[model samples]
Target: MDFGVAAEDEAFRVEARGWLGEHVGAVTERRAWERALGAGGWIGLGWGEGGYGNRTASLTQQVVWAEEYARAGAPPRCGHIGEKLLAPTLVAHGTAEQKARFLPPIAAGDELWCQGYSEPGAGSDLAGVRTRAVREGASYRITGQKIWTSLAHEADWCFVLARSEAGTRRHQGLSFLLVPMDQPGRIEVRPIRQMTGTSDFNEVFFDGAYARVEHVVGGEGNGWRVAMSLLGFERGVSTLAQQTGFAQELARVVRTARETGAVRDPVVRDGLVRLWAELRVMRWNALRTLGSTGDAGAPSVAKLLWGGWHQRLGELAVRVRGAAGGVGPVAWSASAPYEMDADQHLFLFSRADTIYGGSDEVQRTIIAERVLGLPLEPKGDMG
Candidate 1:
C-alpha cells in the first residue's frame, strides 16, 4: 500500500519530464513527438521479452512516467489506444504472427488504432451487439455501423466487436477483429460535431469491409472476454496521466475565481475547496486501485469518480467566469461561428462525460452486480 516514489523512480521521473518538455507540442506536432518518443524506447514499456518495452519497469516507475508526461503538458497522446490498450492485449492473447506484425508498427508510432465497440443498439449493453460478420473464403466481410467511435477518421486500424454466429445473443457469438480502415468506398467516416464545434468523434460505416482470418484476437466466439480485457487496459497507468490535465483545468478555474472576485463569494470559495480536496482523493484512489490488476469493478469505480468530478469541474469553471462565460463570440457564420473560449469548451464538452464511454447508470450497475454480488437488474421482454 506504500505510494511513495522510490529513488530510482525519481530518476526516471526526471528523465521522463525532461524528454517530454523538449518534445511535447501542439496536436499538429504530435506525430513527430510520438516518433521521437518511440525512438527513445518510451512507447511500449511493459510487454515482456523481445518487445520494445523495459519489462523490468515496476508499477511505481510506470506511474512516475505517466505522471511526469502529463505534468510536462504533453499533448494528449495520439497513440494511447494502441500502446496502452491494444499492444498489451496482443501480448496477452494474440497469435505469434499477429504480435510480430502489429506490435512493431505500433511501438514505432507508425500506426494508430481505434475501438469499434459501441453501436447504435449495443453501447453499454455490449452483449446486444448486432453488427454481423460473415465468414468468407479466407476473410470475414464486416457490414454494420459503429457510432461515437473516437478518432475513427484518423485511425489506421480498428478492433471491432461483431457477431460471428447468427443464432447467438448477448455475449455469445461475438468476435474481436482487427480491420484496416483504408478500404476504398466500403468504409465511411463522418465526424460527429460536438458542442465544441470540433469533430474528434465519428460515425463509422462498414459496408462489406473485410478482415483476414488471422486478424481475429482471442479466437472467434471469445470476443467478450477479449473486449473486457481491453476495457481493463483502458483504466491502466494512463489514468494517472489523464488526471494531470484535470489538475491544470482545476488550477485555471481557481485562478479565474481569484481574478474575477468570485473568491469573495463564500459559496464559490467552498465549492473550489471541495473540488481540490476531491481531486486529491481521486489521485490516491487511483494509486490504490492500480495494484488490483484485472479487477472488473475497479475500472468502473474509477470511471464513475472521474466522469462526475470532471462534469462538476466544468460547472465550476463557468461559475467562476461570471457574466463573461456567456459573452463569447455568438455569430454562427462561415467566418467565425461556434468560437468558444477554454471555459466555454470545457462546459459544453463535459456535458457528455457521463453519457459516453460507459454511461453513469451502466457503471453503477457494474459496481452493484459485480462488486457487491447483487442480483441482476431485470430487463424488458424483447419478444
Candidate 2:
C-alpha cells in the first residue's frame, strides 16, 4: 500500500496544522489538555467539519490530525475513554438511534464513557466476565463489580459487557449494555489509586444497575464479538495516537539532555540512543498497522514494543538528569527537580502500560498462536 499521503490527506494535514497552531498552547497537564480538547473539538476530530472534523475524511486524514496535534504538544485522545474506545465501538455497533443519541455528546466532549468489560475474575479472559444483567420487564438489573475501570469516576456512562444468560457457554451468554452512570442504583464508582499516587482508575459497583432493554448495543450472545471489535480498535487505532505522543516525548527528552550537557556522558548517550532506536521502530510499526497493510498481529507487536520503550525512555530521563532530578517541585516548572519528578512519575506509570491493555505476555501469546501459527497451550486443570 502507498504510505505516502495523497493530495487530499496533505490538504487535511495543512488544515489541521493550521488549526492546532492557532488553538493549541504549551499546556502539558493531562486534565488541562482534556478541557482544551473538549473546547477545541480536537477530542473528536473525525465526526464532522463544523466541529474541527470532516466525517467523510479518510483514515489518513485522521492520522494527520493525530500527528499534528501530538507534534503541537496536545495530549493524546486515548487519555479520554469516551472519545477513544467506546465512541468508536458505538459507531460500529450502536443502532442509528443510539448513534444519534450518543455520538454527538461524545463528539462534543459533553459526556464521558468508560469500559466495563473487566470484572474481578475476568481480564485477559474477557469471556469469563460474570457481571449479570437480568431482564426485568422493561429494564435489566445489572449486579456485579468492574475493576480497573479507567476514569470511571468522571464518566457519564459505561458500555458494559454482562452475562444475560446463565446456562449458556461463557462467550455465548454475554451482551453489551450501555448503562447510564448517573441513574439511581446504576453505578457506584470507587477510586483505585495507582503506583503513581493518583486515583484516575476506579472500581465500579453495579448494584441493581437498571438499564433499558434498548441500551444493549448488539443482540444477546454478541458481546464477545463486539468486545473483540473494540479491542482491535483499541490496540490498532489508539496506538497510532499514543506512539506519536511518545515519539514527541522522546524527542523532548533527547533535546533536554543535549541542552543540559547531560549527553556528554557516555552511559547517558548510550541509553538515549537505545531508546531512540526503539522509539523509531515503534513509530514505524504503529504507522504500518494504521496503514492496514502490515501483519494482522502488528497491533500486539506495537503494544509490546511500546510498553518496553516507555519504560526505557523513563529510565533514560532519570539517568540523564542524575541527582539533580529529585530535588524539584512536583509541578511543571523550569527547574531540574520538576523535570525529574515528571520522569519519575512517568517511569512509575510506564510499569502499567504492559499490564493494562492486555499484558505483554498476552500479546506475545497472541503473536505466537495467530501470527506464527504455534500450537495452543493446553488449559490448566482447575480441579
Query: Each candidate: what lDDT?
Result: 0.84, 0.74
Flag clash pairs in model 1: none
Task: Name the candidate that leads on lDDT.
Answer: 1
For model 1, what is the error of residue 366's alpha carbon versus the real structure, in angstroms, after optimal superposition? 0.7
Judged by whole-model lDDT over C-alpha atoms, candidate 1 comes out at 0.84
- Over 1-383, each residue of candidate 1 has an lDDT whose tens digit, in order, gives 67788886887888877777776763357676667777877878767676645344677878888888878777777788888889989988999899999998888888999889898877778888878899998999999999999888889999999999998988789999999999989899999997788999899999999999999999999999999888878887888887888999999999988888888889998989998998999899998888686576988888999999999988888887763445432324567668777887888888898988799999999999998999999865321
lDDT of 2 by residue, 183-253 (tens): 65557899997666678778999999988898888776788888887776676455666777787777877
| Alpha-carbon TM-score of each model against the true structure | 0.94, 0.86
Q: Which pairs of residues collide in model 2?
A: 48-53, 328-337
Clashes of each: 0, 2
Q: In model 1, which runs have C-alpha deviations exceeding 4 angstroms?
A: 26-28, 54-56, 323-335, 380-383
